[model samples]
Target: MNNNTQTRTYAYVAAVLYAAIIGLSFLFVKMTVSVAHPIDVLAHRFALSLLVVSIPVIFGWIKIKLTLRDLWRIIPLGLLSPVLFFAFQAFGLVSSNSSEAGIIQAMAPVFTLVLASIFLKERTSIMQKLFLLLSVAGVVFIFLMKGSGMSAGNFKGIALLLLSTVCFAGYGVLARPLAQKYKPMELTWVTLMVGFVVFNAASLIRHVSNGTMMDYVKPLGDASYLGALAYLAILSTMFSTLLASYALTHLEASKMSVFSNLSTLISIAGGAWILHEPVHGYHFIGALLIIAGVLGTNMSGRKRGLVIPDKA
Candidate 1:
């Protein structure tokens, strides 16, 4: 086959793989968080992923050729994405039901688009902007209409989730060019390591302050907890990261954002099966509208200013 045909084929494969990774995400999240605290789950998840990738570092399969200049970019990507993003997202998952959290997270692409416009100077079509707006409205609708057990106590969780989306969105936009420069595998290797340092340091602080690193370790005795942790660290973090990087190589940043719409569906199914969370009809409707908005935004491509690469 010609080069263009080969590239398009890889893009299609990447899209499917990206969707699968997202679909499986909530299941792993639910499994991991069940026995451990959210922070612990995130901390160990990154730590394990770091360990898994170390083989590449050791064998020179991947090179960490980062300069002081690259540090500026790498630091923010690490901080916003795997560090703050996972921290908040995990906290949000713990505080709220998965169903609600899933619905809320469906707005990530919309938020990403907004951040892309501000940070990356990415252009969005007018219709793309409108659909993105509509997607946000759908999220607000979920918050107001369906209810999220939103007390002052859980308000922080909701806010955190929203903030995490912004961080992730910004990362997506900024990382695109980086993805072009470094192969996704190489990029993930570096970024995941950066994230690991930040998260493990934070984990260290928390553990020391509490005088209780033992508590986090104790959960490893539980079979399910360990299994869940393995799934998340290996499958979700390592494998998914690799798959997503592959997809980003193949697809346009704007086009890839559309795959994030699948997360709500996956989360809903996962919530129902794993968390036993109820899925209200309104939730389904909201999800549908959100997906529609994502597709519309992509197809219209009219506004061209607000594109953020969506995540797996």
Candidate 2:
């Protein structure tokens, strides 16, 4: 295959894999946070991810090329994503249901589209804009349906999740330019390292201040908690980020972001099957709109052809 075809193939594959990883991540987040504080979980997840990713680079199996200037440019990308994105998500999940978190995350593409248009100068047709609204309407529909459940705590969680979506969307737009200059592994490694240092330091300070230094390690004992943490650290954080960085190198950020909508369906199903979360009719309806919006927003317009008159 040609280089363009190969890159597009990789982009599509990465998009699918990233979607699946993130879809199932909500379950693990919910599981881990039940026993550990969100900040503690973030610290452990990034620390483990940094360790796993460092092995290859440390052994000379992987070489990452970066100058001080490059580091300065990419640092903001890391801060936007793994640091701010996951921080918001970890805390949001603490107060919100996994299903709600998943649904809210579907809005990331809309944010990405707008950001890409503004920063990357990507064009969006009127239909694409409408479809983006459709996707958002789906989320609003769910919130309204759950009007009775809109406690102040739930509202806070929802707001945090939306903030996380914006951070992640910003990451998508920002990573595209850097992707042109860096290898996926290089970007992923730097971002993971940044998250590791920031989250661990923050957690350490919190633990020391509260005299919960020992409590920070308490969740490590439970096999279930450990398993969940392993998934979040290895698969959800590291692998998914690697996939997303690679995909962004090959695909437009707006198009790549649409793939995130697939996670909503997966999260809803996973929540129902694994967490035994209740599913209402509105969930299905909202999911349908989300799916349609994803499809419509990503669809390419067809060219019109002039037809010659047939001989009589």
Candidate 3:
């Protein structure tokens, strides 16, 4: 196949995988949160990723080529994308149920579109813009209309979830220029290692201030906790991060962001089946709108047939 055909195939496959990751991530987070504090769990995730990425770096498959400037980029990215985002998300999850959180988190694509428009100056078709509006409206409708039992506490969690979206939206746009220059593996390894360092420091500060240093240390004794940590660290963080970075090399951010809506569907299914959680009509409606919006953006792009400079 020609490069164009090959690239297009990879992009579609990447989109599928992106959706799968987002869907599974909620379950993974839920499991991890059961045993470890969110910060502690995220610390392990990045630490394990740091270890896994070392294999490629040591074997010369990828190299660590960090300059002072590169560290500057990685630091903000680590803070915005992983540290702050996860902290808020984990804390919010402790208060709110997964179903509500999932719907709120699904707003990421809309957030990405708006942020990209401002920071990346990426243009979108009129159809795409309308789709974005519809998706946001759908989320609000879900929150407002869904489930008579929804509480004020759930709304608070949704608020935190929206904050997480903003953090990731900023991360996605800023990451494009960095991802283009650096090999995906290299970028993943470096940024994650930076995250590990930063989060561990923050965790330590929390430990000291809270007089709960032993709480972080105590989880090591429980085999299940350790196992959950290993799964989250290795599978969710290390494996998924590498796969996403690889896919991004072959896909557009807008397309990839749209594909991310799959997470909500996956989370909804997981919630209903695995957690035995209830799903309301509004959740389904909101999810449909979100997915429709995402599809609309991609279809709009193809219809316009305008070439966007590669900012994957």
Q: CA lDDT, every prediction? A: 0.69, 0.85, 0.71
C-alpha displacement of 72 in model 1, angstroms?
A: 4.5
Q: Estimate candidate 1's alpha-carbon lDDT, on a 0 to 1 scale.
A: 0.69
Best by lDDT: 2
Q: Give the worst 10-residue stretch by lDDT in candidate 2.
A: 302-311
Q: Write the per-residue lDDT of candidate 1 for residues 95-151, one digit (tens) a residue.
A: 666655556666677766666667666787777778867765665666577655669
Candidate 1 matches the true fold with a TM-score of 0.84
Q: TM per model?
A: 0.84, 0.92, 0.87
For 1-312, candidate 3 gives per-residue lDDT tens digits of 987768767767766776776676676677677888888877767777788768867888766778888777667766776677776777777767666666677677777877777786677777877886676667667767755364787667667777887776676776766666766766677667777898788788889999998887777788877776776677666666666666665555555666666677777778788788787777778878877877777677564344455543
Off by over 4 Å in 1: 5-9, 12-16, 60-72, 134-145, 250-252, 302-312
Model 2 residue 208 CA deviation (Å) reads: 1.4
Query: Model 1 clash tally?
Result: 11
lDDT of 2 at 280: 90
lDDT of 2 by residue, 1-312 (tens): 986667678778899899889988998899999999999999999999999998999999999888999888889999998999999999999899888888888888888988988998877677777887787788678767866477899889989999999998999999987886788898999899899999999999999999889988998999999999999999999999899988888777887888888787788888899999888999889888887887777664312321111111
What lDDT score goes with residue 191 in model 2?
94
